[model samples]
Target chain A: MARAQELAMRDYVQEVSALTMRWVHRLRREKFSMLFTLVQPMLFWLIFFGSLFQRAANSEVMQAPNYMSFLAAGVVVMTVLNNGLSGGVDLLFDKENGFLERLLATPIHRSSVIISRFIFVMTITSLQILVILTVAYFFGVHPATGLLGIAVVLLIGMLFGIGLTALSMAMAFTVKSHGDFFSVLGFLSLPLIFLSSALVPLSAMPTWMSMLARFNPMTWTIDAVRPLILSGWSQALPRIGMVVMLLLVFDALCLYGSTRAFRRAIG
Target chain B: MGRTVAIETLKLAKAFGDVKAIEHLSFQVWEGEIFGLLGPNGAGKSTTLRILLTLLRPTAGHATVFGHDVVQEPDRVRRLIGYVPQERAIDRFLTGREHLLLLGSLYHLPKDETLRRIREILKLVDLEDRADHLAKTYSGGMKRKLDLACGLLPNPKVLFLDEPTLGLDVQSRLRIWDYIRRLKERGITVVMTTNYLDEADHLCDRLAIIDGGRIMALGSPAELKAGLGGDVVSLTVGAADMDRVESLAKSLKAVPSIRAISTKPSGIDIRVESPEKALPAILDAANQQACRLEFIEYHRPRLEDVFIAQTGHAIREEFPSGE
Candidate 1:
């Protein structure tokens, strides 16, 4: 029984990895789009948003030494949020074009496809976060916890991202067309971003809004990530643990929803 | 009598809200034969394929592929079959080779074995020369061939093709037909759906004509055509006095049966038996009715005649409009 279980687990891993490589190949082929999806938004935030807050760097309203440092974790988490929410577009295209049907017809474990998608989205988002952090480093903003803090930030982003990617995929399966998908994305993305601590810390928001932001996963992610960039391991680790627990619960719920959505769509 | 059944669906039915996509669709495909599900668009051919391939659950009844129940043991059924859908499923960004390799990997083919089979499949589909080109650069037929290559990558026991040649030109259609034949030669049981009567006649060893979510007729193409019996004499007449002309043609002695008479904007098609003996009488009747004859032809019974005989409607007339 143990041997059989081990073999099955090995097969599952192999299949998931193979499926993930398909997305990797596709990303490699559409190098321009991949680059644009990552670089363009980060650049917009860094230059446009960064310059707006530059004059208020050391102001009492700002919590960090500089606007760039204050905004770095926020931008990283925002990039992750953007990428994670839009990751399901690939699955939507596949479903629209009948590729999903072909994939589903194969004998491989069905969940591997979803797992591979999460891996793909997280991998791309991680790279984008790294690029943003590197640029911020050059601009005299550095993580207080240094390399270790950056790793923790990525972990927090990925944990938060898994649930978002899964939820996006569920929406992809639920909706009828790409138009409906984009409309929903357009309606939801800005609200989710603005309501969180992405552009501004939760403290800067109105009292009622701050209370709501406390319940937002993005807020939790940013709260956990911010101290690593501005303050150090002692300040970051406890929040990181809390956010990780929240993400675990979020991921479970989203995975359950998306799997049900997938089954319904295919059926 | 002991031939193995590759696939069997027993009283299978699927419904979407008020619409029944497939109703009581029961059929058996013997091992190593090319079977066709013949129907026009929206006739539930695709829905039936989806059920058999375990992509969709049937609302009632059961289907099995190689004795494994589709719903109960979908993974087992999936392992035994591959599906090439009507729409081109190839990623436009990937090369033909890359597509095959990806599919092979999904099938859990080993690295070396996958490479070997990719080469073999590329050759089998005659896509070796252009295998490295991105699929977006491929022509319609090339892309279809690539789709076929992906389906064949796993060496599945049964291959399901839904309208394998729906929109291809004549030459491309013939190429797909030949590839399907090769699949049969390799002893793969093929279940395909096509709206084209000639494609059904030329390729299917046995076929079931489905329309309005039910099987209207089922038999080998020759058997279905033979069921109609006798030849078909078609007379194209101007729209004037069509009802009178039809009644007159029905009165003729040589016309044992007025198989079908269809009215179009330009003309009316009248089918009768024994054209050689019936032509003069038909013409005489047309003249007496003051219906100007536009065209006339005689041909052996075809699958279209069988479809018409079974449903009292032309197969071509049922093609989904605006598609």
Candidate 2:
């Protein structure tokens, strides 16, 4: 019995790795998919911040040493979140195009397919964040917390991103249309991004809005990444612990929903 | 399970809401034989194939591929059989070579074997020349050939092809058929579905004709044709003169050996116990009616005649726009 269980575990790992290779192929094959993960978030950061707050670089209200630096951490973490959510759009496309049915017919573990998508989105989004941070570093964005801070930001960002990805995949299975998925995503994304500390200081916001931000996963993520991007790991340890705890809860909920949806789909 | 049958379904049935897609479908395919599921659109041929591949669960009963239950042991069945889905699931962004490699990995072929099979299967499907080009840039025939190559990559013991040449030109269709015959020569059991009567007749060693989610007939091409027990005589009358010809032919049907007469858009088609003995009377009637006879042809019964004899309608009529 023990031998059988060990064999099954090995099989699962093998299947997951095989699926990840295909996910990598899918990511590399489509030029637009890659650009959506990396460049889109940078563009959002440029247009929104450059327009709303022109003196962000010089204002003490920025609180951080450099305004762009403070905002860059938030943008980086947001990129990870959006990238994970947007990964499900590919699953939606697969269903519309009939590829999902084909994949389900194959002999791999069903959950391995979902796990591959998570790993693919996580790895690519992390790389994109690193690229943006490297560019910011060249432009005088200091790393007050250093490499440990950067790693903490990425770990929390990735976990939260995965939770969003699972939720999006659940939506893809339930809502067949790309337009419906986009509309629903739009409904949820903007409010979460704005209500959080992504754009400005939480102290400047009203009490009710601050309460919403505090309750938001994005808010915990920003608080975690901000200190890391500004002062390094020691300054962000307590916030990172809180973000990790919230991420675990969120990931559990999304994963449960996604697995249920997957079973329905295979039917 | 060892030699009695290579594939079998025990009273298999499935439904989608109120629509019964397949009803009590039970059949056995012998080892190393090309078994064809010949049917019109919505006749449950594709549905049966999907179930055998473990893509869908049976509502009742069960199926086995090489003695493994399709429902409970799908991974084992998958390891033994290669399935070419009805739709083109080939990733468009990847090259033909890349697609094969990815599928090979999924099938658990080792790295060296995967690379070797990719090269060999690419050549087998005549895709070697376009192996490096992105699949999105490939022609329809090329993409289909690549799809076939992926199915063949794992060197499966059995292969299932659903409408393998549904959208190909005549040349491409013949190419796929020729490769299929080669696969058969190598002793790979192939189960295929096609609406093309001629394809089923020419390619399948044994076939089942399905209509309205039921198997109306099943046999080899020769055996099925022989079951009709007569000859088919087709007369092409001018569109303007079909009415006179039909009336005359109907009047002659009472004569002995004149089995039946049917009117069609192109002309009048008749089935008789012996066309050689009955042709003179048909010609005589046409002459008496003063109807222009465009053409007359007589031949032994074929798969189409068998389908018509069983269903009382043309298989082509059942699939109005499938082609």
Name the candidate that leads on DockQ: 1
Per-residue lDDT of candidate 1, residues B224-244 (tens digit): 987776677666666665555
- For all predictions in the order shown, the interface RMSD in Å is 1.0, 1.9
Q: What is each model's TM-score for chain A?
A: 0.94, 0.89
Q: Which ranges of candidate 1 are over 4 A from the true structure?
A: B236-247, B253-296, B318-323
lDDT of 1 by residue, A57-175 (tens): 55456688778778888889889888888989999999999998899999888888888999999988888889899988888888899898888888888988889999999999999
Docking class of 2: medium
lDDT of 2 by residue, B123-236 (tens): 888889999888889998898898788778879888999999997888999999999999999889999999898899889999989888888888899999888777888888
lDDT tens per residue, model 2, A148-188: 66776678778888898999899998896899999988788
Please compute the TM-score of chain B alone for each predicted structure, in the order given. 0.87, 0.89
Candidate 1 reaches a DockQ of 0.78
Model 1 clashing residue pairs (backbone) = none
